[model samples]
Target: MMTKYKINCLIVFISILFLHSGQKPCFAQKDGDDIVIGKYSIIHSSILDEDRLLYIHLPRDYEDTQLSYPVLYLLYVDIYNYFADATITTEKLGGTGEIPPVIIIGVANTNRYRDLLPAKIRGRNEGGGADNFLRFFEEELIPHIDKFYRTKNFRMLVGPQAGAVFSLYALITKPELFNAVLSENPFMNPENADFLYPRAEQFFKNKESLKNFLYIKCERNERPQNLEFAEKLSKLLESEKPEGFRFKAEFKEPSGYFIPPIPFGEGLRMLFAEHKLPENFHTNSVKDVISYYEALSEEYAFEVDAPSHMLTFEGDKLSQQGKTKEAIELFEFQLSLYPKSLNALMRLGEIYRRMGELQKARQYYKTFLTIRDTDVAMIHNRLNMVERMISSSAACRIEQEIRKNGIQAGLRKYQMMRSDPNNELYFDESEFNAMGYRLMGAGKTDDAIEIFKLNVKLYPESANVYDSLAEAYMNSGDTENAIINYRKSLELNPDNNNAKEMLKKLKKK
Candidate 1:
């Protein structure tokens, strides 16, 4: 039995092998295209106040078409070319209705710690340089790209780890700089929350209009702090609901970690298709796309291939190029070809849902459930009243129980609940509050605060409530409030480790 970790590593290795082999000529093998892949230099005055070197890989078809494609800007702090193969693969497949094509711009760092850090601080190597570095992008680099290339108005940015910190800053400060951004595995900690939350709040309040797609994929090995930060950022993005602001968060538990690159790659391709030149470069009829996918499935049935996801990958790119109808057709075709494919079915349903075809979406979801009865918890939740009405009374009762007691419990509890409709059910808020404590135990003070707030609202009299909230607040730099809450919590319980520590910390502050 191949474990999930082994599969993830195998995929990563194969992807690297694929890139170096270059059997696929989607990367810059052609000439006379401004979307070239090479190093360029710019004077960095604003953030670093020094000269900066960067690399960019332009799309293959960029030169031939007068239209401009959105650029995916990346900061290669430590890792390099993680997505180069997938980027090219997506673009090549997109050209032939397999994925979307977009320019890849890689920004190399002479002093990554300095350029990507949000603050001007000491202790780190060549610290206190981010301001000058960002200045370089605004004053010199972006201007250079616009002048040199026939680019689209849209842009995207990708960063991992330290670079992800910078990406978060860009999202908040320069909200309009990129139409989409990806921040993977940011090394979040105590310091990040102190900075990020205030900035996020300010960003949401000030930047009233933000039409961008933000994708955050936290690795399974990612620090708990980073995971907390990602969760917080995701919730904030969802809550704001800015115009055209779309967001996705993939937890990618150890078993699912390797799957993130697929979505990340797919997202870029989709954004590329949205801004691709001539728009109709990869458009096709529904019949044609269905046939193509059917053939693909036949070719890769025995292998652990991503054939089902491939069509969605293609649809994303097409959608990017303003061929939404074609994109929808392809998604629908993918479902028709592999009615049981979870990825294909979900994508089809999503397309319909986005288009406001709720009935059609529900039908696809129903079909999907018929194929795979397990792991349909979220899909079942998304169904509208009409679609839910089709379920048998017993099924409806089960679903209601599931909604009330979560899918797992509902699975087992359904038998008992079915036998006695009058059985009393109570959701233990203390257990829910304990979940927040567990997060805090893992050093996720910021995320724990969110959970604590909910816990307090639900169980205001719980002695643990004030302690957790005060500790979380103190950790996040709200000293005055921490003091207030510490007193309140201590009033409830004279003995509490959290409240005592928090009070001591606040008093020192």
Candidate 2:
């Protein structure tokens, strides 16, 4: 019991335990998994002339994978390590049959109030640093990410709370940042809400390529102002006839992490939901909206793509107009007729997953995965489910062992780097995305928005950014602005039914 070998081993074990315990546990713990957290700094803001420190999360497979991966950059609080634990935890929890495995970039705030505010300010609460912050994101942060990681052009952004407000500003002021945006619990000042809608119309008045996704959520715990603001945002987005914007919105009670799954997932589903794909949806919002557009095409003696250019004046025309069952049937029929259609297969898979038919969802998702050559942002999440469902003890053991060693070894290095204050941490995009979502949960909206906008600029070809920006705008009560961005988004992808619906509502108001 007192041998030197045993004593040495005991000391090492105790040291590891102590170090791990001291590390923050922001996320919930799985049975045998660990989250790697670290911090880094860069000169991101030119106006402020200050170094900004950011937190990063590395996923379980980050070190294991050599293939280039897509990135999701998340904005967070102003502090160097604020919400660091929460960010890691949220991503871990969301990975379980919820969202995707993403790199999280948590930007710590040196001056959140200054950087996130869209207009000039005199008081501490008011901010005017938005433009400079935007510039920093577009020029420095994004380029840094591209250079430092094995990243494809595909990217997404995320923000929450006041960060959602800042995100809206970025969406309207500069629409060419990221391909997709995910925003949670935005703050919509009444004055700001009024300013949003008209600005939206102006932004999208000129036709532009707008392939983006905007996913927004409003928690019910806040004042009536929040809900009312969300409604206004919905109206504004619904009015515009954008081509590529996919907008999905919902109001729900706040959950602890990364927004609640019910509404947030629903929004995600709507924004990216696929239709039957052999006749793939176009970027012009013409072929992908709904049957109404198809019927209108014939009645107006217009081309099938006519709706791509036409302004949808009456978005509510479909209210109580179609049966859910019939809608499902049509989607299924399209898939049956066009087996190679990406949109159809994705929709079918999502529908099956939602209906708790994991097997059917797996089949469609597998098919989609084979054809999906671009970013598989949510692939890891799906893979986790597949692995769990396979029921192969050998396979399970192998994966478990790999994960254990991976997480534990990563944790060890992570602690060493964190302890060394002089050292910096490196991260890819998936880690950044998880960080962004965690920042949202902690009510750091401004930083999150900046992160997301940068993503849009980096990946202009993606429609997901527009969708994410629209959600951020809605949270901020900048419905007018949300609508304009949504229109711009629709311009990129005409098939997004969610954006079309939101645009119709905005027009009605």
Candidate 3:
């Protein structure tokens, strides 16, 4: 029989085991039914001279979408899972247009005190590996992540407690590594606080501008020492901040030693405040929204497109308001930005059909078919109705001409018809390019040249058109004209690699 003290210790041990087992695993299990939050990977860090595990949570559509996402690197994930939960929730909100999608990378620690502390104390053995740890992230982990993931240049760092102190150290020491920093109740006692405060002040003194977001929050009922340090640091940053450095500090009622999700969510909202679209935006012109995001892209230093669902909703609202022309234009503009949007194509087709434009409706519906394979029955029925309408209308003559003559002659006839006040025949630049390529493939070099020339006339500023014309001229042995057009193409877009190469070859000849 065991003694009473031994029995009590056994019970405590069993309880601890039960609690730990109840927590979520950091990696996916082999069972097929369980949902995987993230995967586990290892990095061999030469700076730290150790192998470290990385817990990575990618966006849900990461596997399917070609889009890149900003990264959020969180520290001390092994001790607290709340940060991961907060990151995942915030990312979901971002998907709903509250912010921008972000990839979460959780760094598991080998030695918490040694890796987090900035320097060694007089009698401490395990408290001065912070520089090596930061070097590990900078030299090894970041490059590995970038190579394996579709990541944008924007990055954020987040931490709590001692990890938070490390975060601030990285921010002050290597400001260029991350675009944002979130530190929750950083461990700032007198010694480290004195060391860090001056460094931050000196950093700001030298820099003219710092385009980064920094948020530091502390608990209201925290230890007096920690709270005092937070206040001092916050005041220093507020007083000596450089231009373009977005900084915020907050003191909340005590939650726990670990950061609660509420403050984390608030920090994320504050950091990406510009990413959200205005709630009261109401416009019939899509250009207004596009221009708003274009300006925001310049501010954020990343290209951002208007959300597709927002565009669709606004277009539908415009259509319901009897602004069909504006709705059509909005949908067309959406297609121009995102050609893969089947919703825009379908909406345009329906709007044209409602306006009794059978030919235009048929064109959009056919494009929808080309992009997607679903809705076969509805598309075929609509196409048949459009064909019936076209067969009984005067547009039948243009279809007969296209069938009787070649594409070039048909295009010429269409142009002639369009010149008449009664006819509305239309041809786009893509149609001309396609026909030109087809003619070029069939040894009709002169016809191809004329088609490309017509395209250049239609779109004078298009470097692609001039480049195609130059290529046609080269094929036809007209080096002088080819050189002229190639030079024009280079002037329009100096980065046109094909034109540069062809020009070099032609000049060599």
Candidate 4:
């Protein structure tokens, strides 16, 4: 997603997080639980002559995969006021794949005025310490975060209110550091206005292009001074914004602080709007898709693949036209690129099942179930259906054993099939997980718990298995056991917000 930063040059303001709690926070923790979203970390800064607190939120797959991600630096953390908003937004966007997953580093302010507010009027000498803060960002803090955590070169810096002015200042002074600057409602005085055009002239006047994004939005509610500044800055960017320097001003919608946190999501979306696959890019030809993404990679300076949906959409069209073989080819190509892509896996499974290739269909379905990586709720039952045709297969055979005798007898048959060297039966973690859920749905909590326990034993490293066990335990009213399994799930996958919430709820009991 290539979002041009929304730099609202004068509609400046500070925000508080208790905004979401629907009441004033007497203290920080909600419901006696500590911070819900991200954790607290400290970095001692020599340039700022103090220790800085940082709120860091990692993507869900960070611990699971060796993939590096872009960083979103949210300024004025001030104990997670904007930090929570930013993390929540990114998590949703990332989950839906509207935007790629990113590591969010919310730099909490020890002294908000000293660090964020760069310019000072006649009376204020306390401000204007932004230079040292930028140095800390450039020299000390950025390097520290980079060294300790996995981060891509692509970085975004977000600043709200006074912080926005400082972020815009960073754009002019250290444009090389960030790919985008979302300066939200900056306080632009005459000094800032005077400080802008000439500096833009000096820096961007000679360059062929900047290839950076700057988005600004001015607040409204009878602030004539801010409105005046927004107009002047809009004109300045129009004249001086270098080629490829993406810039946009003014909101098409009313942005009154009904917790106008919508702009936060809006600015992010604008910056990376290009990250999404366009309809024109969707074609039946895999070669065309590759070419499009390759060009996009060159533009973003990062490798971007055709989204699974794009490939699947084209594949679906092929299948609808009775070109099953071609659809299979396209889906195979997609699977090779995105090995864990559920769309590709499920499409192939459906195609293979229709062609009477049940073994291949089962294999793809098994893999998809193991991933269970989806935000969409409707597909869960469909994915676990296992067999589309009623056959005397091993899956049905095991179910017969369970009904005739019990879970132990079913396991005996499964083990016999699994242990044979030339076994026709299929055994998989996903298969067991699905069976467990089916048992749970049938009100067989005991059988479900036993089956889930077997899955935990077979795939001990699988966080999803532990999550299943925890849920089964919870359903059986075993709070102590549920808490135990949920803790293990969370330990394995820190991005398990469900496990975290469940643990919090159970602990309060």
Candidate 5:
């Protein structure tokens, strides 16, 4: 809820934060327990000669990935309602993937009159220091954030009432400071109204065009003067809109509600209308997406690289189109940009596995495991399947060599490789048993027998290898060899019930 104080009693904190950016934010500090949604960061401003408190909230995945984000400078953080609403609203907007995720910098107010008011009144607590405050953001706070944090050039400004007034002042005074402005319920006093219009006229006359965004909303129970200002400003902006400047104004009083909304979510959305992808955007090729973001960067006046999820989805589209090479390229490029992004990692692993690049698939899947252990079972299953594929590949190669040269030559080579314990192809009884069963399933009884025999050489002391060899022999109808191996298996482990039963059956046969 907004305070019902008169304009002269206006003690406001301008809190502005939105989503999406990619440049660099300056370094700052953290202390005290006022860390709510974000921590209380202190930026010592030389311009104001005071320690300014900034509450900074970064993207959810900022710590995990290498992607930079846009800056959303929020005012009115001390006003819990505005700060809470903006936080929730921006999250919802970013969730839609329409607008990129932004680093929210909510600046707390020290002096409402000195920072938020542009024109001074007759009282001692009168306004007129808004420029110095803006300088604090431009010279001290913003640079501090940019230097310390990963930020983009597309910054947004937002505030309410006096804070909103300051937002508009920043919009016109320092047109290049922020790319977008969301001003809610800002009413003009006689002094600021006199100053703002003339300042705007001069600025508009001087600058050919300004690429920016403005969304103004006024609710009912607001002063008639506030409604009047909102209407007049809307009409004025309509006629004097600059090239590439976006504008939207909503007067909820006409809708019969004077409720002070926590923050205007729709205002942020309209300002970033193009940030959301179209319905069929995923249907485009990777190059098209790259170009889309490239052009968006150009339009936003910043280097707006496509976010990791965008790249992941685009790469998936490529995979679906039978464009394996393109998918790999896009996913690889995503990894290069984001570095260990789960989306890219998982996509690359799945695609490589599908393409039968077992080693590559294993590489990606293993790396994915290190980043996030949430899907341990699923990832482990993929790794196991990859290992089986690799083992099968080695088995087939050895089989071919046996066919080309001699069984003894292949056996000698296998023995030589097995001497090195670190060989990836080295396996225990379970893998050998699995590999042998795969060959048996393929109706390659001779190959299965040869694989089982290799397993015997690897785990000669283990009963399972001999039991598996016995089954392979029985499958090939070599009753004599089956009986021999089964007897040996039972000798190695007398408690081998399967071996005992198989020996009895073969003896009867």
Candidate 6:
């Protein structure tokens, strides 16, 4: 039997072959329309005293959802379309969830030599502007992109040759700026090598942990000097062996100065190897997996949720194994982390409906409708069936009472109607929150405010209830009440960033 690594390599090889074979040949391509792969934007760089062009490739679902993604900044993009293509394709075909979607930003260069070299050599006139370039990149380019995009704090920088030298410089000087560095065929001449080796030694000498991924690749036969330099650098990094820093070096066959697609793909795979969920992972181990990645997120200073698809897959497996409660918990956790996930809502709706909980099913189905616009016939049929079931259910009558009278009065009536000890009246926090939102959407601000206030009274310990009440008050133009409720919500749940931002905005007003 092949090892898992070999199996994965085979799959990637096949995928690359399939992609290449499926695409139109280079010479046979027709130019009827512009073959646009990404968008172009210009940023005025105050550090460089000039404007720079930024080429950005957003993921396919970027505009459809409010999900934040990691960013990949590629240097020397003018000659590296293959690298961009590989990255994009790998992300698109995220087979085992190893490759998460990323926003690719290719920094087009105006003066490659000047931007890549760290310092001026004896005879080089077009170099020595690397410091200025890095300043422009760190201060102007990155900030502008981050402000305009829904981006995670995670960043990766990829470069080749002299650009790779620049990437190494950044790794030694500003390790916090990027979470990963992919250096391909670094032109580590004596001058560049001497400058960088000292910094690397000093950086590691401090006994500080460097929590990042570094992948360096060089062709053995391309240039003897650069290859030797790459080997020495790799050994030095291994010797220091900073904790939490993952280092990998590959000496490939001669491929000239270009970074071959195979190494590029492998580098990315190595960088995100821990991102994929194991095939044997079950519901019991889900928490452990989440905890592991959560620790990684803390170490890397970014928010990293388990891939939604992997969670859904595991939830389905658990549900198939007659583990309904576990499946429900898994889906609920997924929704808690990614509230905008339509799949999680749909799964919860299906699970509740299968379990004969019509009210909960209807609630989740309705929530799914609010988030997704896809008109699946099966979902429509299930939603219709759920609505019909709810109309004839006893819970419907209690909700009607709540709408007609008030929450307290409705609860009193419900208790009187169901006098048995086991037949208790149940009204969850989410149900009330949903009802309040519906009323708010219908322009009944006063009624919505009442409902939300009642929810807050019923579930005072729930931070979400307070957040809902705060939102309702904010919508009603009651800034004081909104600020107070938002503050209360934030006090209860300090991680409620939405509440904190709303409070800030209301206070500014």
The digit string of per-residue lDDT tens for model 1 on 153-228 reads 6667788777777777887778767767777787565665567778887677566666667777786676778787
What's the number of clashes in each of the models?
16, 86, 0, 19, 31, 0
**TM-score of model number 5:** 0.69
Error of 4 at 500 (Å): 62
Model 6, span 191-307: residue lDDT tens: 777777788888877756778899998887757778888998888888887887899999888765445543557788888776777666545645765786788677557877677
TM-score of each: 0.45, 0.43, 0.62, 0.62, 0.69, 0.65
lDDT of 6: 0.75
What value of lDDT does candidate 4 attain over all alpha carbons?
A: 0.73
Which ranges of candidate 4 are over 4 A from the true structure?
1-36, 95-97, 189-197, 222-225, 251-254, 258-262, 308-315, 322-341, 372-509
Q: Give the TM-score of candidate 4.
A: 0.62
Residues 115-193 of candidate 5: C-alpha lDDT, one tens digit per residue: 8989985556578999989888888888888899988878889887778889999998888899899888885777777
| lDDT (Cα, tens digit) per residue for candidate 4, span 1-509 | 11222212222211223223453333433564423456778888888888887878887656654557889888877532576668667866665556777899888877776776566544655457778889999999789879988887888988876677788878888989888888766766555556654665677666678989888876665245556666666787788778888988864455545434525677778877876667565455567667877887788776665555567777888888777778888899888766777778888988875554556777887788677644434345544454542243564566567878999998798778767898765546776787787788778998989878878877899999999999999999999999999999999999999999999999998
| Candidate 1 wrong stretches, greater than 4 Å | 1-47, 86-90, 96-100, 120-128, 205-208, 255-263, 269-509
Q: Candidate 6 — which residues are off by over 4 angstroms?
A: 1-37, 60-67, 86-90, 93-95, 121-124, 205-208, 255-259, 262-264, 285-289, 363-375, 384-509
Candidates 1 and 4: which is better by lDDT?
4
Q: Compose the digit string of candidate 2's lDDT tens values, residues 1-509.
A: 11111112344345435545744443445665532343454545554687776555554445544434345666664322224433444343333312333455656666665777565443446666777888888888878777876665555666665566677677777666765677766655554555555675677555454666677787777557656776667676776647766776777656664433223345434532331122333322213455544663343222222111111211112212423234345455444434454555665565555443456777888887775634555654764564454443222222233235743343354345446677534322333333334334445555445444544654566566666667566666778877977887899999988889988987787
Instruction: State the local distance difference test value for candidate 1.
Output: 0.60
Q: lDDT at 507 for candidate 5?
A: 82
lDDT of 6 at 57: 75
CA lDDT for candidate 3: 0.75
How does residue 315 of candidate 4 score in lDDT?
A: 85
Assess candidate 3 and give its TM-score to the true structure.
0.62
TM-score winner between 3 and 6, please give it: 6
Better of 1 and 3 by lDDT: 3
Angstrom error of the Cα, residue 347, model 2: value is: 30
Supply the TM-score for candidate 2.
0.43
